[model samples]
Target: MVGSFSDIGATSTDFCNFRRDLLAYISGADAQMVVEDMYKNKEMEPDFYFDFDLNEDRELCRFFWADTISRKNYVCFGDVMSFDATYSTNRYKLIFVPFTGVDNHKQSITFGAGLIAREDVESYEWLLKNFKTAMGYTPRCVITDQDPALKVAIPNIMPETRHRFCMWHIMEKVGDKVGNALAQNMEFRKALNNAVWDETLSVTTFELKWAKVMQEYNLVQHRWFDQMYKARASWIPAYFQDIFMGGLLKTTSRSESENSYFGKFTNHHNSLVEFIMQYNRAIGEQRYHQKQLDAKGESSFPETKTPLAIERQAAAMYTKNIFYDFQEEIWEGNFTCKITCKTNDDGGYKYTVHETGGNIFENEGVEEIPGCYIVPRWTKSACAQPMYNVVWKACSNTQGGNELRTIANQLWNEFYNCMGLANGCPTEMDIMLSTMQELKGRLQSARQQTRASTTPQSVIESILNATAPAEIQIKPPSVAKNKGSGKRLKSNKEKATEKGKKKVRTCATCDRPGHDSRNCPERKALPDE
Candidate 1:
């Protein structure tokens, strides 16, 4: 029953109370003896034995002891270093997390320190120094956000080691700045994505292509590109290129994925120590899973597949031919034809053609002609040309002359009009004259009908004539003056009172009624308290 209390609901507080009660029960001289007996009995219990050493083989024992003893001593020997910083909720925190790369399967965190000021150079240097002390040696590589502080501090502290920017952090920044439009423009997006794999092209070429992509999507130029370019040499892990870094010299998405795991435990915990413990436990579980995965021979990760090479090959083959075909369609016409071919310096061919006396009246390349142009019968006959015209003459009713030619000419003109081209059709003036003559005949018929239907009547004589131009009548000067004087008096009154008077406050000092605060010297004096 006494041991059951320790087993069932044991806590530090509970254990402290238990210790006090046991001490009081045993009393003064027997307390130490009773404690030793209790400890030895608890140690002998199978449950306690199993809890401490259940899977403790000689190898496991050696590893456990070595890790335990070395970690304390190794506190001064830095081995694994991680440089990570985050800015959220308007506060910046950097963490130099130290770990021991004990086995391929395990990394034991030796020590970690949180930095309040990420941007300060001294703060980052302090973190690196702490990391160096926590692990057994200087870190081989420091992974961090692409922070300027880390760039400076990492090199200064561990000059021989590598510094890497986190790929996930950069991508997040790209999303925030460039936005979904980068994804919307598929070609530009592919170009940007492909930039990582383009080793044949120099970094400068990649940068230029990147700029072109940003321009295509109308994204503002960002500092991230400069950061990426600067960190290209070190951040790309040589051995882990394809396996971990996606074959690019950029940060991995692992940090972000880890951060997300941490986010789940963030609720209602105000203690930093609690947060760290929970985070470490989570990390342990993740390591366990990763170890299982590794045991299954699946530790190596696959690189992201970039289709840039295939796309470039396809584009190179098709682009020029497609452009030529489009231009040929625009130039298609029928005529007496002349074709000219020229060879470019690059071994490519350019073709030009001129077509005369046909509906299709231009030249085209061999590639440009439509399938209809190759019809055997149409090719043989000159009249079958796209723009062929037939001449026609007017024929009397008694004898129809050249009716076929007239029909052909009308059809040709109609086709020309449909094509929005002037191929020698009659002018608008001719159309207008013919329309007016037809209208004149209709007008004459209407006039004859009106004449037949109506009768006119007139008066016989006028008895008296009216006189011309009566003498000019004008108002007397006195009446005009009286009329004008009334308006003048009103105008004079309006002029005298143009705008209403503004109320003016009297100045206290000057004792003048028209002035306000600006002219009041009394207002400028200091008031007595």
Candidate 2:
């Protein structure tokens, strides 16, 4: 019976009975022998400790610890830690994780353990203290979502760390301030992202880009971006190289991984101790596997490199077709043609060319291709290259050894026709003069119309001055009317005759509208005046 009670299937009651029976059985045994047996069994059992504790020296355990510690230190010392707090199933508890450094190539390293706390300060303090304690030093940088508690606690604890607000969080706030479409636009979003990263750009550049984005999105002044930019110096890291704490930082993904690990053990166990034991066992196995992998190679695999030759080949293919077509145009007289210039008043000429019996065919009223243009939108001063396509196309044909002398003469004539002599018709100064005259005429007409009509400002001011002193309108006191009684006015004689009618009065104490003050309890209780 005692043996059965001590078996693996033993209940709490059975355990108690087994202990009692064990005492009875051992009471007469050799005490020294029993003590030796117990000691031996205890030694045989594996040593168990918390995975996060400093004493966890297993190779896999060391790798996890080193990786996590490295990432946390990097984020703290270099990047911003964007933190947010959420509740667990347990009441009066909070969990905080820093969201940042997520990328496609590799997972972020700054992710650390989830912490529990009763209040904001406690939670933030716990996170900072644990980080410092684990890394054996303070971090130099921090980034987080704007939580008041974290904002307060960070300066108090890690004062040296550069604190930054998360751009994602800022964007969310902007969406709330503006509309969803503005926040989601690819071009606008790209511009906003670039604005945040552009170190060489002035603060005005940032403002201009922000305003453009807002205007494009049709957003009103929500002050979200303005407020964020006000604290920009504090939120963004000073250097891109320093942002990752030398590649040690990760975002809040570690806490998520921990949660998932915890879930596996928690769902199958009812007892807290049992759950903990199972969790540790699973962790031990994982650590063992990780250690084996680490010893053989690095924690992560190396990425493959692409060849430069392939890229060159691709670029060559894109530009190949243009060369053959240019040679054919040069063989025909159409390559070199004279362009005649029509002078405008603004000292500029509109250039046009008419071919005289050339093999080159001209299509009338042809719509311009999307990307191809005769003249580019803007010209660069440093560029020796011609802005007009006409020069390049003619030159390409000439280089192919098929240019007629007559066609070149015609081209030269067209160039001179557009550019008028110093005092003559096709000068740039004439074009400017005409444009100015047109503008002046328009302005004079606008002024005449403005003088004829009353301005809105004057009208508003006149109305303001003419208005009477406003008075609050109060409705006359209402009397409940009897449905059967027709609208009637009591004459002065009738009012005097009805004066003997019992008057209903409201009690001051109870606020009942029928009783007199004399019957009021509160009124009666007061001293008689």
Candidate 3:
């Protein structure tokens, strides 16, 4: 094309410039049309949304896209979100931001996306505002890489949401702060990981262990450790474990996974139009895979390793993926741990659990390691509270508490029947419906019995025996009278039938055969006729 243009009397310098302009026009026109089509069909595609900002030259700068399915997934599983704005792909240099979560099948789900011209705080705030508006609610927690501008903007916009820095992202940078010699130290890495991943540790315990490690490594003044210790609440699991996160996310791993998955669809050489096209294709495939998982989970139940009621209950209660997690916990709780002591505390029972084999929390230089997992169990009410917590209640202290204790003991027995401590004995709408059905059944049965008793065979037989056939009588045909004199005329068929048929003589007064009322012997003779 450039050579052809040069043959048409264009200068040598204009050759490269014309080629650039042609490519720009091609990519820009397609990009603009993509956004325009999304807007044009917004009414028909109620969930489809796209917004774009233009520079002074009316060129596309920022764009946001979210379909209806993304909005609904956010509503269902958006309790915890991982928003990443780090990936800069395509020729336009736009940063890709995806709102991601985990569905019930433990699959990565994209909630929404944004593309920005810049990575400044203002761009991030705009993206977050639009995402919140599209999703209709703020997530309970948001996890992201440690971006200084995002840290400032999040508290301003999502003040109520817990903003946490991703543990994996921070851990990946540990080698940069710690010397290479210390980075390769297996013991050092193990201790640091324990401090980061152990949610059961108390704040004081974590601080002590962290201090001991720093002292042992002779890095008390390390700037990275100093900053991390100061901002520990945002990254530490011990601080926010009690908060409801819906098991959706803990780090930016979901976002990284999404990027890796989407990488196949796009690259630096692609145009904006190609990027959008590949994005749709990627999202469609992701959803298709999730649907396949959903179908598999619905059709097949997870296999149980034990006959425990709680295991069965979990399989019944949770999705297939979640049930496996629950099953693993049940297996771990029974196999690797045991109840050390049970004590009464504040109208509830506290059970101390101790790990038996391969303790996870054995520190160096300590003679005996702490293996107890402390879990506080409290009874809030009489109603059977269904809570999804790691803590298990052995008994409650309340009115009729023994019954509750018996039930708990039964559950514990079933849970640990492999080890066997002791084996012992053992809605309102449903009630109303059962009662109504019972009454209806009884009423129908009574009506059937009454009909059977009232219509006996003897009464039916007597009525049939007494019934008699009725007698038939033929009447004489009447004649039409003449106008002047009382003369009569009759049809020939009627007159002949009347003459041929024998008439039974019956008196009108007595209604008896063989006697008219005027000549009856039983009647007194009239004196003067």
User: Cα RMSD to native, each candidate?
Assistant: 43.6, 39.0, 43.9
What does candidate 3 score on TM?
0.60
Question: In model 3, what lDDT does residue 201 have?
Answer: 86
Write model 1 residue lDDT over 421-447, tens digit each, in one string. 433456754565577679978987997
Go through the candidates in order and give the clash count of each: 15, 34, 0
lDDT of 2 by residue, 1-529 (tens): 3246454454788666743543333222222222233333233322110122111221111101122323322333323333444333121122324333321112233334342323367556755665544444454456555667878888887877766555555554544454556656677668766766565556566667667865765543546665765676654333333444322232333334445554555442122122223434545565465345333332332221333332332222222222123224433424465555444535644545556665333333222222343112111110133222211111122321134656777878965665544246556767856875799789979977976796544443342222111331211111112211224576454566588585756677787876766787777788979
Better of 1 and 3 by lDDT: 3
- Extract clashing residue pairs from model 3: none
Q: Each candidate: what lDDT?
A: 0.41, 0.42, 0.67
The regions of model 2 sitting more than 4 angstroms off are: 1-86, 89-114, 180-190, 197-208, 211-220, 234-242, 245-529
Per-residue CA lDDT of model 3 for 1-529, tens digit only, reads 4247544655767666753544444432545445544654464455666676665655566678888777666656677788776453566566788788877666788988887776678878888878876666788899888988799888888888999999888887787678669879999999888877887888888888889988988879988889998999998887787666555435888888888888888876556655776888899899999778666755777789987776775565466766677678878867787666777767666666668764443222222212242111111110123222122223223434356768999977864762343233215445545766799789879977886776333333232221111321211111112121133466454566798797788887667888799877556454655
Q: How many residue pairs clash in model 2?
A: 34
Query: Which one is best on TM-score?
Result: 3
Q: How well does candidate 3 score on lDDT at residue 186?
A: 97
